[model samples]
Target: MKTLHDLHRPLGATGLMVSPLGLGTVKLGRDQGVKYPSGFTIPDDRDAANLLALAQELGINLIDTAPAYGHSEERLGKLLRGQRDNWIIVSKVGEEFESGQSRHDFSPQHTRFSVERSLKLLGTDCIDLVLVHSDGQDVEILKDTGVYETLDALKREGAIRAFGLSGKTVEGGLLALDKGDCAMVTYNLNEQSERQVIDHAATLGKAILIKKALASGHVCLDSGVDPVQASFELVFGHPGVASAIIGTINPLHLSHNVRVAVSVIQSRR
Candidate 1:
């Protein structure tokens, strides 16, 4: 089994190699209205730095963030300036959270502006991956909006390396796989409704990233079963999964997740 220390793999056909475990930064920015099993204080700068360093040390190279994730992009900009080349940044557009409420915008104009803003906010000249944050109207947005066309243009102009959708429905996921480089879908023990999306991505040779792989901390492990290990086993068991985005602010939890991921991968061998 490939250990977490050597878990890097190609992200579909993007030509970019990424760690099998991507670190999600939603908790780094937002704490309110979140659905975690327990409350957590947002980490301070020092703590954030430590956590990032720990993630890197554990061989995680993909960092998932978004404009809707409070100040996540800004904080990552400040924290990851000198280490830009060391990570593949996956950020989203079309969704914004303001005043504790969420809103969606998939217009080409907004998509372009959002990518530009994300580049500036993350202090990077180019983003590795950008996904349209869907508002549940996935098929409609893909059909009515020019977001995909706009992102393709940006890719041609060297503003972004790849683009896709963080979509809701299986139909939307299939569309995204057909039209983009990857798809971020929700798949976990509690919710396996999106497994077809992963299967489709595999058939199409596109990347599939698992979100809420642990049921967003709501997974209840049976006796003698470790939640982290069980969750990772299920996720990584799928050949289509490029990475599982685990959002954990606690260094201990992060380390344990890494260990479990390594064990699961090794057991698969």
Candidate 2:
């Protein structure tokens, strides 16, 4: 049986090795304004801790969180107190969620502040990776805003090891890699519009982390096919993909995802 740890790969030239699947924690903090197929309750500390332990048992080492994920950073800070060194923490800047709403601030100052806050909230001296939480204005945010520049400075200062954009556009992903180390783009069975970004990343030796790999749990595949298996096959089949961030607080689902992901990855070899 292959564990996810067996399939860990380099995240571009960032010097950070990550598993093929990362745990996304949006459901750990916020339950509003989400686009999931069904509603879910936020897991309490015990449940969340169990899920984290299960992830480790299944060999996941990358965790994805953001300030826009309500109190996710703080919760993980407490939950992962002694095990910080075991995982690669991937966070974001420029988007904030409060009072059931979200807002964007990509200014240099806010970017700096967000990174500092994320550090504090995550209880880490240095975040392994920090991506710009873009607000659909991907091109403008990268070109007009100094957000990437600020993140580059933070990386140099050792506050963050790598930086890039969790962008919504192909242009933004390419530009982000041109300026940074990674780009988290949407790539799955339903949407291959960002395929160009993945190809470009492969060519340039940069990282491409995938989001919405399961279509936010609304996967609509053919009747006979297993959605989860198909999703992992499509994601890991691409050589450029570093990891797919899947958000699920359910232990069974997490285990299943890791199993399918490992099967796909190992078969490719």
Per-candidate clash tally:
1, 0
lDDT computed for candidate 1? 0.92
- All candidates: TM-score: 0.98, 0.98
Runs off by more than 4 Å, candidate 2: none
Off by over 4 Å in 1: 1-3
The count of backbone overlaps in candidate 2 is 0
Residues 1-269 of candidate 2: C-alpha lDDT, one tens digit per residue? 44787778999999999998999999999999999989899999999999999999899999999999998999999999999999999999999988988999999999999999999999999999999999989999999989989999999999999999999999999999998999999988889999999999999999999999999998897799999999988898899999999999998899889988888888889
TM-score of 1: 0.98
- The residue pairs that clash in candidate 2, if any, are none
Query: What do the candidate models score in CA lDDT, each in turn?
Result: 0.92, 0.93
Give me the candidate number with maximum lDDT. 2
- Maximum-TM-score candidate: 2
